[model samples]
Target chain A: MAKSRVLVVGTGGIGTMAAYALEKGGLAEATAVMRSNYDAAIKNGIDIDSVQWGQVKAWRPTAITKNVPDVSKGDVAPFDYILVTTKNIPDVPPTVADIISPAVTPGKTAIVLSQNGINIEKPLIARFPTTPVISSVAYTGATETAHAKIYNDDPDCQKIGAFTSPQVPAATAAEAAKRYVNIYNPTGTLDVLYDADVAKVRWRKIAYNGSMNPIASILRMDTPRMRMSRHIIDDLIIPIILEVRAIAEASGVTLQSDLVDVVIHQDPSDTGFKPSMCQDLEKGNLMEIENLVGEPVREAERLGVPAPTLKIVYGILKGLQLRVKEEKGLWEAKFQSGNSYE
Target chain B: MAKSRVLVVGTGGIGTMAAYALEKGGLAEATAVMRSNYDAAIKNGIDIDSVQWGQVKAWRPTAITKNVPDVSKGDVAPFDYILVTTKNIPDVPPTVADIISPAVTPGKTAIVLSQNGINIEKPLIARFPTTPVISSVAYTGATETAHAKIYNDDPDCQKIGAFTSPQVPAATAAEAAKRYVNIYNPTGTLDVLYDADVAKVRWRKIAYNGSMNPIASILRMDTPRMRMSRHIIDDLIIPIILEVRAIAEASGVTLQSDLVDVVIHQDPSDTGFKPSMCQDLEKGNLMEIENLVGEPVREAERLGVPAPTLKIVYGILKGLQLRVKEEKGLWEAKFQSGNSYE
Candidate 1:
């Protein structure tokens, strides 16, 4: 029997990790689409420093190309899974749907969204109408350590769920999710669970991401440092999770009670990994402040819920994002401290 | 008759401005306690670039001394008013009471607490129980432009209130407040209102301070830049004020509805001045994170009230404060960004 073939889009930490996962699962073949890093990825392959995947000095795939047309050679094999692993930043060139849409076959291709935050798969579902969409709640603390090498800390089970938004029908989503699950969990490489309630799973993961990601960025500290300061985390990190819990509750998504511990319970080894938001700011890349912090906070506010902490965190992240943009000569956004405290 | 002598302690922006106010009022002889810039003050007097008091190239006070022991002459005549204008930081040396206790007489001297946030006069009240205290809510947007020269944005009014905390009896406080009002309001140097409920007045000012002060410092922005972005202030600034209002209300101190608007309306001149927190971080001086953000947020939390916005801002400011302290050879309070956002 021919092995199931998958296409990985955007070669950041997530894309590289997914490609590696596909190879390690040993039941599928992986092809990646890289634009700027195409030559480097093809030449150097993809080096990853992860506890789960060990050290792969050079990870060369069966096939690696830039655009959709050249993703797979010959008579269009129709990719079974198109896994997107790019940063969900707003207002940048080359959106997810735009890059991954052309390659997806009407009935054969299923877009596996391995992204953070909620209400993300809607755009792909909207753009690809008939394509089955599965949301991946990636729980690993991961980052691209070097140009092509990726680092994973606190490697945990990846949660797969049928994204049943208003756009996608339940039956269709469940069927696609099952197929994706079969591919994701063959040898139990980072045990991927198929959650029927994807929204809830996404919300639960957000409780961790929204709190730790932006905070680590703003404070310029990692998970270990957060663990080191009891008061800072207890006083700060936990409260942010509580706010997110409030947001989820307001949105009528009942998150699990142990969700807050997602932030508190961490492997000290993962302490070395920087969150994606901090990486975005440092690399002068645009951030996903809206998706991670702003959107959920807005949802809570819309429901007349008090989410002051989330809102302020969103503001700071957005401010930093704007600062990065201004530095890049994209736009002009300036402010002063007004000596108001004095 | 020799004029009533006032001693302005901790010569920053507020100290410099108060000295100018006293000199312009003409009812009292103003003396300053300047340790770091004693020579500068003695040599150059106090140069002020204020909207209220035009520009004073050289305005010498009656006396400029360093310590509390030498505040007054051999007559042992206590200061008519020892207006403290220092940042109310925690876990630091020379607290409010310790710094001004030596110069305060039992019945004669009134220590005007020109500070922001709640319950700040407690220490002074504890140390000098019999000495009357007046709480001043200074509304001007001012900065210490030079060593002694201060730049004032809105030199409108400094609300004088009789502090009736547990240690202060209302009658004694009222009488002292009246005297301070006489000194503060002579020739209408600044509109000094004698608020019978000083706690309420202080709480209202916290609505403004807790929102703008730490935020300005974190973002390194002034008031005018805050005005440029409506959403940033609306989404960020107003919510923080609302949180403070919740804190105040939870503490049974009702804040005015218009308190949030205090941050919205700004004099353009205030744009250039750096807030005290920003100035502190820039100059590597210690911040008042505890008094301004921590204490109030803790008060709210203790009362089963949610003040998440205040707490996170406090965390960031404290982190910055810790960074500054570590840099200054003070102590080990360090954390790296870990490139988490990357």
Candidate 2:
């Protein structure tokens, strides 16, 4: 029997886990691609110590590709699943479309975006007009401690669906959603939810993303402080959440109003946890600032809805990202510290 | 003619300059009180390198006092002027009243508050009802370089008046304002605007402090990035200004609508300037978070007006301050960092 082929791009903590889960579940033969940590990941494979999913020791992928061209074109077998776990930033080089293009093997590929933020699937969908694309929202307390090594205290569900932007839950049929869920669910490693209301779910996740990611990152503090901060929740965090809800409503998605309360009072988070944005910031690496903060803010602004909290937060995080990227020289362009593009 | 005695408390960068300006201005026989930099200030006097104001080398005070009692009682003549320059954090002990109490010698002393934020004079005003109190707004490009030295790039106006909070600008008559101005104006170093509308000006300054101070501090960013942040100015800063204006109007002062524009665009805040809040955070010292961010937020909340931006920013900053203060353990009360009282 031939195992299904899955190529996971952006092999950080999230990608590593998805690859590990897929292979361990006996659902597919997974391949991973890495850039800087390529040699380490290729040699060491991935080691994730997750409380929920027990232990996966040296779970190497079936194949390792250094670059996207290798994963997309160099491989003989067409990938059944192409998972992108990188940040979805606009304008920055190597757009997700560019990275995932070579792997779009028509009938064979199912482009699954298991990244953060909302409405991100549109651009990738636009690029691959005919290819089946799946939007995913992964909730896991996971962070990369070292090359190919992740330490997760808690693990949560990953929601996936076959829906485009402005597409509501009712519009998205269950066939692709079921197929996407089936790929990773058998592992019993994670709670995989087949989401019909992916737009709402994405927006719901974004409510958390917009509130937690940038604010926590900027404060350089973690979830415990943020969750316990009545002031932060009542004044800062909730307003951004509500604003996201309003933006969603304006865009004709009826999100559950209690989502704000859910995000605020959630446990384990109250015990203090750092989101990926904060984690990346602490490491002085580039953050998903544009995707998590900028995109929603601009979207709300475009819809004539005012999201003051997100706007300012986005500005601060953008400044931080620019400064970090500049200092780390992670990318080509450099901005002088304390200076901006005037 | 006998010299009029002046006592200056809190010799940080702001306090250092005010002491220098008072001495160099020859307005009074100035005595200074310092906690951390007492010996340095006593040995070196105060050195100020100014962009607008000329140099002042070893500008010694009439006397240097370490404690308020020393300044209030150690000096021979009664203090005609009592200047307090530390932050006004509520319930933090050594409140503004505590710092300037001994000098509140009935009519013999005129209490002057040249600190940042709004209605800071209320406590001192309440303590000495009969004493003439002056409120001041100093616009200076200065940072404490050495123990007793401040490097000031620009010397701007010091706006002063004698009025209580909720008092309209039109009601302010500036006899006390004039006298206070006479003391600091003789330096010919910084421009001194005897603001009749000190209420409006203070509110306007709060518009800046409430927005820029906490945001920048939490982000650990400075003015150029903060200023270059269009989203910050347009979305975060402006909304806060408007909210403050609404609160001001609710409190019976209709601030000029253009104050938002002025705060966002007009200030000659030197490039790469870090607000006092940011400076405080960097030192891991206690911040004026409660006063600068908390007070107005609570005030707005009390006034039945929603100040979402201020509330959230206040929350994040308060968290940062609590965390920093806990770690520094400058005083006894430890806020279980990352733990909420609830």
Candidate 3:
């Protein structure tokens, strides 16, 4: 069998780690798409110090390209899987799907959404209806501390399954999921499992992302400080978890009963782990607000589930995003019906 | 008759303006209690650049005392009124009422709470049972841009009313309210009017402080930017105002039907006004969260009013306060049960 061809969209920590894993599996050739760190990555490769894979000095993928469209120009085979590991900020233009659309081959290329958010695959599925879409949830702790320097302390583990639609049949979607899992986990030590119901896993993951991420961002607190605040844990965090759980249940996904407590104690009490949203706010970067909080809030509204906590939280996150946009000169006042406040 | 003797507790902008106004009226002898600004105030008095009263330099009160106990040490008659113009942060030790208790003569001194908050008079009234309590809301644009330098742009206006209690009769409370309005507005040009129902005024004021103040602090946006964000005004601010109105109604305070609209448009849309709480958060100072949002939330709970907005806003404000406290090294981890996330 010919070796599978894989394209990685974002060259952040996750993308770099995923490319390394696919290349180490020996069944796939990984081409990393680098934008900002292209010079450093092409010259020095990537220096990774990970707990799972220790002391990887200057690891480089099979191929490197500056743009996505450049990949499909020459005589090249179709990419079997294109993993999008970018931040899921949907409000900004040229979304992840749009950026990766140029390289996707309809009905051939399976797109994997390896990001932190719910409803992240909708845009890709809408753009390429016949293409097999894979929904994935990653549980690795990977970060690029400096240019081309990656630090991944946590183990590499992820759950991926097919996102079926009318255009893609269930069997085909399942086959695509199984093929990508096998290609990405040839050593079987990467813990890349094929989940039958990815939506359930997404909802279960949202029980934390939808609650803790935004709360920590709003409060500018890490996990340990948040856990130390009794009033916050009981009043704000728990109620928000219940709201997310209620919305999940209304959408036909029943989260575990003790899910609230589990989410609270998921991390150890002393871990000073800051959520991505909190870090984004601190760094004045755009956050994954729309997919992580906004979409679920709209879903709750549509499902008639009372999500007061979600609404207030989404409103706050939106306001914070506006501040970031204003600082970056990206905010435009869109007026409607003669009201400026809108 | 001799001029009425008054001691102003806080020498901030409001207190300074109050002293200036009282002395300008020539009906009260004002003594300002200064802490950090005591040296500057005593040596140079205060520099004023005002839109109402243009360019009055080095304006000093009758007497400047460093401490409250020192004011009552000499062979001086008891103070007729003790104006507690301090920030109303009750959660911190040695509250405003406690600090001013040494100079307060029970049944002789009228305690004035010229501060921003709802239910501020409760503490003072509790400290002095027979003493008349006055609740005053300030509506002036004043800020101390530098040490001993004051800037007052807007006209000085306030509403003075008696906070009646079981120990103080309505007639006596009414007399105290009338006497305060008279003394505070001797020129009759300063818009200090007597309000018969002071609780109604407080609830009306809270429709703004309890909503806009905290929301702006959380979002870090001024009035203009907040008014520009339609989502914030329509989704967050308006909903919070409605919640406050509901809580007020449950407490038998019939706020005006157009109170919400009035609160929204009270400030012009183009003005860049930052509320006190917003300023406090930016300057890393203790905010008036306990009285401004906490008390109203407790009231909503007590009256069976569904105030989800208030509850969530209060929780966020508490978390922010914790951040400030931690920065100042004032937070204590009080463990109750087994869980620390409390």
| TM-score against native, each model | 0.81, 0.84, 0.96
Residue A235 in candidate 3 has what lDDT? 84
Per-residue lDDT of model 2, residues B1-342, tens digit only: 456677887777677777767766776677788877788877777787877567878777778878776334555567878887777776467688876776667756777787877667777667777777778887766777878887887665677777653332323425656776777776444577677777777777788888778777866877566666566566566777788888878767787767866666544344566778888889887788766767787778778988877876776677677677567764233234433434
The deviation in Å at residue B238 for candidate 3 is: 0.2
- lDDT for A328 (candidate 2): 70
- Clash numbers, per candidate: 19, 2, 4
Q: Candidate 2: DockQ?
A: 0.31
Kindly report which residue pairs in candidate 2 clash with one another: A224-A272, A236-B312
lDDT of 2 by residue, A16-131 (tens): 77877787778688878888778877777678798866887776788887876543456467887789988776646778988878777865577888888766777876776656
**Which residue pairs in candidate 3 collide?**
A229-B342, A230-B342, A341-B230, A342-B230
Best by lDDT: 3
lDDT of 3 by residue, A158-235 (tens): 999998667898899899999999999987877779898887889888888988899999998887788888888888
DockQ of each: 0.22, 0.31, 0.49
Which ten residues in a row are the worst by lDDT in model 1 chain B?
B333-342
- For model 2 the local lDDT of residue B194 reads 76
How does residue A58 of candidate 2 score in lDDT? 76
Q: In candidate 2 chain A, where is summed lDDT lowest over 10 consecutive residues?
A: A332-341
User: What are the Cα lDDT values of the candidates?
Assistant: 0.74, 0.73, 0.86
Off by over 4 Å in 3: A70-74, A333-342, B70-74, B332-342
